[model samples]
Target: MFPKAHQYVNIHAHRLAISQDEWVLTNLFAGDDFPGANETAYYSTGLHPWHIKDADSEQLIKKVELAAENLKVLAIGETGLDKLIQTPLDLQLQVFGAQVEIAERRGLAVIIHAVRSYNELIEFAKVHQPAAAMIIHGFNGSFQIAEDLMKAGYYLSFGHRLLISDKLKDVVTHIPAEKIFLETDESEHGIRELYKVVSELRNISLESLKVMIGENVKQVLRIR
Candidate 1:
């Protein structure tokens, strides 16, 4: 899957980019408008835990399942547990489990949005043993947590937090190229900048990083 690519692979991002050189997997929440299909643009759709306060959970879950039928929909979420929010943990788990089932059944990856519940997520993974790759998007957690997830066969995506957190930088350097991904994930920074930072941290060429992440994308999304 490493096609000697010069393009950046943004595994997860909220805003769409017009760049022809980059491959952006844009995230569409359950109610968001699904953009018309394009060659460079792909998407992941699910109900986010934060926005589920007033949502009709079953309806949105059905929407995610329907979206999974689209070829361009490569992943199931931007969905996972978050303890900081007021949403009940039980409800979050229920909604998250439903999305995971969709991804697993469809053979797609699951992009996760975890906040202060990494352990819970790990436990969930152990119990469910989901076949779909679980990627922790916008990961700023400790190296131990990163290692634990990686050991459990989960991938970690770095975003704005990598720019500010020295600890996260160390984690990035230690993370295997195949298990690492860089994302914008609602950040203002360009994906290229994150790539540059990571390449420098890992002491590898920018092209190498591009190819590494491109392959990681292929592996996680089961792209040919």
Candidate 2:
């Protein structure tokens, strides 16, 4: 079974520093991708905290607007707060807010790149109450934090690192199975490995979890 493709809402460029060849080959999102041309792009964009530094602010905003407008840029970004970096947190928040506004304006979802700034991010979410769902991508927070985010009605996407987390397991156990999702996030591991961990954690058969996650992924990303 080749990738046994499921409907993916979006695939961001954060994990894709090069041409999007893998998803291009997988046809996991949309129509056929030309062998060498820009891959049949996923419905999302992955913008990490670091990538925005060199990006021209006005141009970046315009690009975000264009993506939200013309292309099927269904998700604003993997943008959020990070504490350890030299990039100004205020500037980051400005960029993050601008993207969020763009998504809000266009009624698109957001793939958040939150780190130690959960409270700040949550506060922003609370105030704006954006219609587009917010998914905490690459989550690695404590169980309490996860619970808090879940209670606040946000979604979470799990990658390889989260799979190895005992704390995340504890947190994940409490998460509504509907909100749980497994992803590779550009890691070498296949979705099957992620599905394996999820199946065990949810105490369901692999096939069952596969069906559930497939449905969940589609629902979150608004995929058909």
Query: lDDT per model, in order?
Result: 0.86, 0.62
- Tens-place lDDT per residue, model 2, 113-201, is 78788888777777777677787877888877777787676788777785678887776666787887555666776655666676787
Badly placed stretches (over 4 Å) of model 2 are: 1-39
Q: Tens-digit lDDT track for model 1 on 28-112?
A: 9988876555544678899999878654888888888988887778898889999999999999999999999999989999999
- Compared with the true structure, model 2 gives a TM-score of 0.78
Q: Taking the candidates one at a time, how many backbone clashes does each contain?
A: 0, 3
In model 1, which runs have C-alpha deviations exceeding 4 angstroms?
A: 1-4, 36-40
